[model samples]
Target: MSFTQRLRRRLFPPRDAIEGYENEELVDTICRKTAAYQGQANWPLVADLTTVLDFGGGAGVHYKTARQQSPDIRWAVVETPAMVRRAMELATDRLRFFERIEEAADWLGNVDLIHSNGAIQYVPNPVRTIRSLCAVAPAKLIWHRVPISEGEGRREVQTSYLSDNGPGQAPSLAEKLVRYERTWIPEQAFIRAHEGYRMAERSPDPREHGTYQFRFVPD
Candidate 1:
């Protein structure tokens, strides 16, 4: 770990967002997510099973521990290279890992559910990234523990998140962690890019520190 990572580990020990979720709260979250997905119209109507793509799912720990209701259900996790390495070590027969959302090119159109939680704030180009996911036209997209404060204000506004996405050493954590990431919030362009997906739910995070949690899906 670098100095910044060392300092972060001291202040906030190595942790995943889902790892911070309590068992009961996590259960409730899963229930809501399932309800939302199943309640959708014509969801996986022709498919015999559901496939999931989780953005920023760490090490596949949550999926590994959680019992799947159906043996037919499958999931793939996309994360940073570091997390991808960790996730690969824990990947199961149904679990896969990708360094980027686009890296899972083969999964396009095959995925039925797209999931993200507390991960939008860390994307350097959320607009473009979301557009990529939207292109796949998944049946449902679920978001949780996402920040919503947009627009410039008294405080300095941060646009890009720092990461090792480029060909260089990783950037400091604060450079990326310190921002609101309002672009994730629905707008005309985002809505158009996301295949007419609209905001279905916006509420305070039941299990984490976020201004709001959002759920978007096409009607």
Candidate 2:
């Protein structure tokens, strides 16, 4: 290994650095973004919505605009254990956090919508996770920033700096890196995984290449 690689291993260590989501600074950044949501569109199908399950919603950032649009909306966020621990502090009567999809689904009783933005690809098994979310039987499902491949699926490592996690200006800091694994699954396989849902809408995400947004409803 190179000298810089050796130094990073010695100082930060892979075991400690691998799961960057657990970092306290990243959590703080996420909470800060929640505050700076800036009226971003929460969900397009916002009308008549009561309860929602936000899969992979770190710090429940979407709740800011959602609450503004639907004052009584009950929102549950399913995140990593580390995120869940730190995110619970932001929870309220209408907003909560969970480490598992099932728990969040149960908490809402009847999830009117399940929304996952830029999250599904991070899981180890996207198909299995998709199936589990399908079991929740939500009235509608929306996935954004989903990386799709036309050929065989593959895994890749994603490196993100602290500033990448933001909806607002971020504090300048020294080179701090967070690394995680993500998968690019075949598009057809991804669609088939949604067993009981039919694709209602499909749109390309202009911000990220090879990523798309998919909306599904009862098949």
Candidate 3:
């Protein structure tokens, strides 16, 4: 919170590159959310499954509700190495974290569901990641808040305030700004990337502009 740093942030904003997403405040918030998560509309989907591969599932917060409903559910989260280190604090017998998709799949034995929320865009290569996820051959793949394009895919920078991730925090000028590069995958290209999977559901995400949710199943 130095004067120079504050001034630089005002001028440059959140466009600064993020490395491993290691923000301490954000980590605290994720841990708190993981501890207190009640549920979401997708709770039933999670509750019905016994094993899941969560891509970009920060600290595996979504497991809270699923664990409540299906006590034996094994949830494996695939995240960055830095995040894996921080998220290990919340790991338990049924919950685990890995830095690679293959490792997660190996640990889970059989993945009933693959889930990702607002995460694909942040990856360096969405197509490569999608291919990796497909290699797991999960029964179902769900993506929420995926940025889609009607034409050729492209990269863009997303800037947001830390409070955006908070349920109770108020916005402030001093709130830390975050910027990350995202790829807007072409609609058709994205759909075709899953070699043997068919797009079971595709719909616009009500909360995010130009983004959609998708569900894929074996063809």
lDDT of 1 by residue, 139-210 (tens): 778777765545421222443223312222342332322223333444344344566687787678877553
Question: Can you give the lDDT of residue 1 in candidate 2?
Answer: 36
The digit string of per-residue lDDT tens for model 2 on 77-166 reads 999887888778779999999999999998899989999999999988999999999999999999999999989899998976565685
lDDT of 1 at 135: 69
Clashing pairs in 3: none
Q: Each prediction's Cα lDDT score?
A: 0.54, 0.84, 0.82
Backbone clashes under 3 angstroms, per model: 0, 0, 0
Best by lDDT: 2
Using TM-score as the measure, the top candidate is 2
Better of 2 and 3 by lDDT: 2
Give the range where candidate 3 is weakest over 10 consecutive residues by summed lDDT. 166-175
TM-score of each: 0.58, 0.86, 0.84
Q: Which pairs of residues collide in model 1? A: none
Query: What are the per-residue Cα lDDT tens digits for candidate 3 across 116-201?
Result: 99998888889888988999999999999999988999997777766455333333434566666889999888888898999999
Worst 10 residues of 2 by lDDT: 13-22
